[model samples]
Target: MNIKKGLVLGISLITLFFTTPYTPADDKREEKGEEKKVYVLDDIVVTAPAIISGNEVNRLGSQVTHVTMEQIQDLNAMDLTSALRRVPGVVISRHNQVGSFGGGEGGAIFIRGKGSSRPGAEIQTLIDGIPKFVSVWTHPIMDALNVDIVDTIDIYKGAQPVLFGNMAFGAVDVQTKRMKDTGFYTGIKSGYGSNKTHMASVEHGGKTERFDYYLLGGYRSSDGHRVNADGELQDLFLHMGYDFTAKWGMDLTLIYTDNWADDPGPIDLSYPSDGRFNNDDFFMVATISNNYERAKGYVKFYSDKGDIDWVNQEGTPGYDTLTDYKNYGIRARETITPWQKGELMMGIDLDYIRGKARFLHPVDGNSAFPEETFRIFSPYASLSHTFGSLDNIYFIPSIGVRHLNHTEFDSETAPQAGIILGIKETRLHASYGKGINYPGIYAKVQDNLWMPGDNRWSELEAENLDHFEAGVEHRFSSKLIVDLTWFYDRGEDRIVTSPPPPFPPILTNIGEYKNRGIEGSITAIPISGLSLFGGFTYLDSAPDDLPYAPEWTFSAGFNYSPVDNFQISMDTQYVDDQYVTSRARMRNTVNTDEVDSYFLVNGKISYDFRLTGCDADWQVFLAAENITDTDYEQKKGYPMPDLGFMIGFIAEFN
Candidate 1:
C-alpha cells in the first residue's frame, strides 16, 4: 500500500508539472512591470458566454454549465440523455449489436469522457436537492423520463459549492419546473420514427387562488431494428405547491415509471443469434419543503423495484429472476443571506438503501436469493463570498464528510475550493476537489451468477481525485461568443474488476489511473432569425481501456426561422477513433483498434398552425438523421442503423 500510494503521488506530480499553464495571476506584474497580452495555451477562443455561466472560464473557484428549457423544447428531445447531446462537454454512446444487445440506446452519458467505463455507478446524479445513483445493471436509468418536466439543468463540471456536500467528482443538479402564480397550461405531443417507434405525451398545469399543481403522463414503445429487440415505456409524474402563509410554503411530487424490453442476442456475424432477455422497473418518490424569509429547506423519500429474465436457445443454460430495491432519505438545506456584496448557503442530508435480488435457472428449476443492503449517512456544508472592484470577482470554498456502516469500506471526508476572477471584459477561474464512490451490492457481496461462494465483496477501495481546471471566456461583440477550458484529473485507487478463474469474473479489486482533457465552444447569433452553435472536446485516458472514450469530439448546428410559423435547423457531429474491449486482460494485452471517425448530419423542419375552438397551436415537423448514412461501429461486430427518419406533432394551449 505504501509503495502504491508513493507511485500514484509521483506520477500525479510529474503529470501536473508538465501540463500546468502559466496564467499570470497578477496583471500588474507582467514582463518587468510592462502590460501586454501574451498567449498561454496555443489555442484561445472568445465568445458571448451562456446566460448561466461558470467559474472555470472566469478564473473563479468552480464552473457551471447551463442548458435552457427553450433549447430543450426546440430540439423536441425525447429524454434528458438525448437533450444533453447539445451541451459542450458531453458524449453519448449506444451499443448497436444484433439481437439481445440493443436495448440500451440513450443509456450511456459521459461528461469529460470519463464516465460509463464500467457497470458500477461512476458519478452522482441529483434531482432538485436529492442525491441519486442508479444500480450498475441499468446505467443511465432515467431515460424513460421526459425532459419537459425540467426547467433547466445546471452542471457544475468540476468541484462545486460547499453546500453540495461530498460527491462532486462531476456534480449535476436538475431543476424541475415550478408552479406559476397565475396561469394555466396544457400540452400534448405525438411522434413516429423509423423502426416502428411511436411516442405520445400529455401535460397540464394550473394555479387556483393560492394553490398550484401540474400533472404529466407519457407512453412510448418501439419494435427496434434488430430481431427480438423491442421496448415499451410508461410514465406518470406530478408536482404541486401551496402557500400555508406568506412566510412558509410547501411543494409535493409523485412519480411512477415502468419499462419492458425484449432482449436481443449479442452480436452474431455468421448466421443469426437467438436468445431472450427482458426487464421491468418501478419507482416512486415524495417530497415536502418549507421557506422562511432568508432560509429554505426540503426532505424527500424514494423507492424502486425491478425484475429481469434471460434465456439462451439450444439447451444452453438460461437465467430468470426478480429484484427489489428501496431507498429513503431526508435532505434539508438553508440559504443564510444575500448581503450587499455576497451570498451564503449551508445544508444537511442523510439517506439509506435496502435491496435484494433472486435468481432462477429454468432448465433444472433451481433458485436462489441474494441479500444486498447498505445505509449511507452524509452531512455537508458550503460558503460563498464575493469582493473586488465592483464585485467583479468571487471565491467559493466547500467541504463535506460521509460515514458508512459497511464492512468493506471506511468513512471518508472530501474537501474542495475554487476561485473566479473578472478583469474588464474577460474572466478566469480554477478549482480543486476530492471525490469518492461506494461499492454496489453486487460488487462487494454477491456476483449474481450461480458460480459464487462468498466472493467477499473484494475489499472496497475509495477513488480519490484532485481536479485542476482553468479557462477564459470573453465576448468581443454582440453577435459572437466563445468559451474554452482545460482540465486535469488524477485518480488514485481506482477500483477495477479482474476476470474469474474460480470465481465469477466481474468487477473486483482496487486499481488506479489518470485522465486529462480540453474543451472549447462557440455560439453566434450573427443575424436576426439566424443562429449558430458549435463545440469540440479532446481527451486522453489511461490504465483500463474504455470503448466510448473518443480522442476527439465535435458538433456544429444552424437554426433559422424563415417565417412566423416555419423554422429550419441542421446539425452535425464528428467523432474520432475510439476503443472497444470485450474481455478482461492486461491493459496492453487487449487488441487495440480504431472505430474509423465519421461525420453525422441531421436536419429538421417544422410548421406551426392554430386549431379552432380548443384555443390550441399545432406543430408538424420531420427529422432526418445521418443524411449520409455513413456506417460506423461503437462496439465490436455491431453496426449502427443508417439514414433514419422521424415525424412528429405537438399541440399547446394558451
Candidate 2:
C-alpha cells in the first residue's frame, strides 16, 4: 500500500467531513402507506444528467452508478459493450466496428481491472436482475444484450456477495422499460452509418388501470470496415403485467436474439483465415410481487437457453464447434420496516445450469459429449437502521450475510457490512464484502473428453475475494455534484493452469492478487439545458499484473441544448497502455505484449420537433465517432475504426 497516498486521502476525507454544512432532514415526508419500496437498485432517472454516464447513491448508501436511456442515445450506442465505454471504472474491448467477437477476447468488459479471464469471467451481466451469459463459456455474450429494450443500467462496482453472488464480483444490470403513463405509445428508430452499418427498431407500450404491456423488435447489420468482417444482429422482446390489487401484481417478460460476427484474423495477416460465430438465445422472466406498509417482497422465476456455433477457418481445413446451454433460476426477496427508521431484508437465489458441447466435425478424436448440470442455492439476510436526530446529522449502518450451496461443490458462507453518514447534501460511506466464484461446467467437460486423463477438474475449490470500499459524495446545488471513492479488493484460491507449457496443462488454485484504486467524478450544470461531466480512475495491482486494468483512465463529456429543440453533445476519453489478452492472467503465462495508449473524441448533434398538426415528436441526429481519426487498438492486430459517421432519427407519439 502507498502509505503517503493513503494518508493524504484520509486527511482529505476528514477535512471534507468537517467543512460540509449540516441541515435537518424532513420529518414530515409524505406517507407511503401499504406501499413498500421495492429497491431494485431503484431510482427513476428522470433527471437530465443521463446525457452523460452518471452516478447515484441508493438507500443502501454504497456505490451504485447508472447510465440512463438518454445517455445511450447521446453516444449512439447499439450494443451493451459500446453503451458502457464511457462509464467510470469500465473498459471495453472489441475487434470489429459493428459486431462483437465471440470465441476470444472480443467484446469484453473489464471493471477496475477485473473480468479479463476468458472462458470464465469475474464480471457478470443481468437483465431485470436475472443473470444472463454464455453459460458454456461462463462469460457474457455481448451481442445478446439488446440495448433497445433497456431503460436504465445499474453498475455494482465490486464484490457484492450479499446482494448478488457468484459471477457478481463486478456486475451490470439493465432494467427493462415499463410504461409510465396511461394510453398507448409507440417509438420507432432507424439509422445508417459508415461501413454500410444499418439499424432499425420499433417499440410499443401502454398502461391502464389494471394492465400494462411493452413490446420491442430491432435489427442491425454492418459490413465492417475490414475485409470479411461483417456482422448482423436481431432481437424481439415483450413484457406484460396485470395488477391483481393495489398492493399485488404479476408480470412476465420474454426476450429473443440472433446475432453473428466474422473475424478477419489480424490486421496484417500473413496467412488469411475467416472465422465466424453465431448465437441464438432466448430467455423468460416471471414475477409475483406485493407491497404493504410494513413488508414488501417478490418472487421471480427465470429461464434461459442458448446455442453458440463457431466456425474456425484456420488454414484450408476449417472446423466448427457447437455449444448448447440452458439456465433456470428463482430470486425472491422481502424487506420489512418493523419499526421507525429500522428495516430487515432477506432473499434467496437458486440457479441451475445444464449444457453440452461437441465438435461438429471430429478432430483429435474429440467427438461427442455428455450433458451435465450445476445448481446453486443461496439465501441471504440483512438489517439496517437509522441513528441520530432527524433535526441534525444522521447515520445508517447495515450488515448482511449469505450462504452458498452448490450441487457440485461444498457450501460456503459470505458476509458484508456497510455504514453511511450524512449531513445536508453531503454523504460518506464505507463497505466490506466477500465474493466467491466456482469453476464453470466448461472446466469439467474439457477434462472429460479432450484430455482423458485429467479427471481432477471437479476437485478444485471455488475462488474467493475480499472487497473494501469507501467514498464521499457532495451535492453543492441541484446542478453540481462531486463523488470520490477509494476501493481495494484481494483475491485468493483463484483457479489457473499449472506449468502452462509443453508438459501438460493442469487446472489448479494457487493464484492470488490484489488491486486498489481511486475513482472520482464531477457533474456540473452551470445553466439550463447544459451539463458537463468528467471523471478519472487510478489503479495499482501487485505481483499478478492484471490485464486490461489500465493504471490511469480519464473521461469527459458535455451535453448542451442551445435552443429548445436543438442539442449538441461530445465525449472524450484517454486510457493508459495495458496488456490485452488472458495470457497476462494466471490462466496462462504473463507476457510482455502490450497495447499503446490513445485518446478519442466523439460527437453528436440533433434536432427535435413536432409536425405542425401532428402530436408525434420526431428527432434526427448526426453522430461521429473517433473524430480525431487516431489509430488505436484495444487488442493486438485488431485496430479500431477511425472517424465514422452515423445519421439517425427517432419518432414517438401517443
lDDT of each: 0.57, 0.78
* RMSD in Å for model 2: 11.1
Error of 2 at 541 (Å): 1.6
Off by over 4 Å in 1: 1-60, 95-106, 132-140, 159-168, 263-267, 270-282, 304-318, 338-342, 363-367, 389-408, 447-458, 497-509, 581-594, 612-614
Q: Write candidate 2's Cα lDDT for 278-341 as tens digits.
A: 8889989999988888889899999999888887755334477778989998999999998999
Query: Which ten residues in a row are the worst by lDDT in model 1?
Result: 27-36
Per-residue lDDT value at 387 in model 1: 62
Native-referenced Cα lDDT, model 1: 0.57
| Candidate 1 lDDT tens digits, 529-567 | 666778888888774365556788888877777677877
The predictions' CA RMSDs to the true structure, in order, are 13.5, 11.1
* Model 1: how far residue 179 lies from native, Å: 2.9
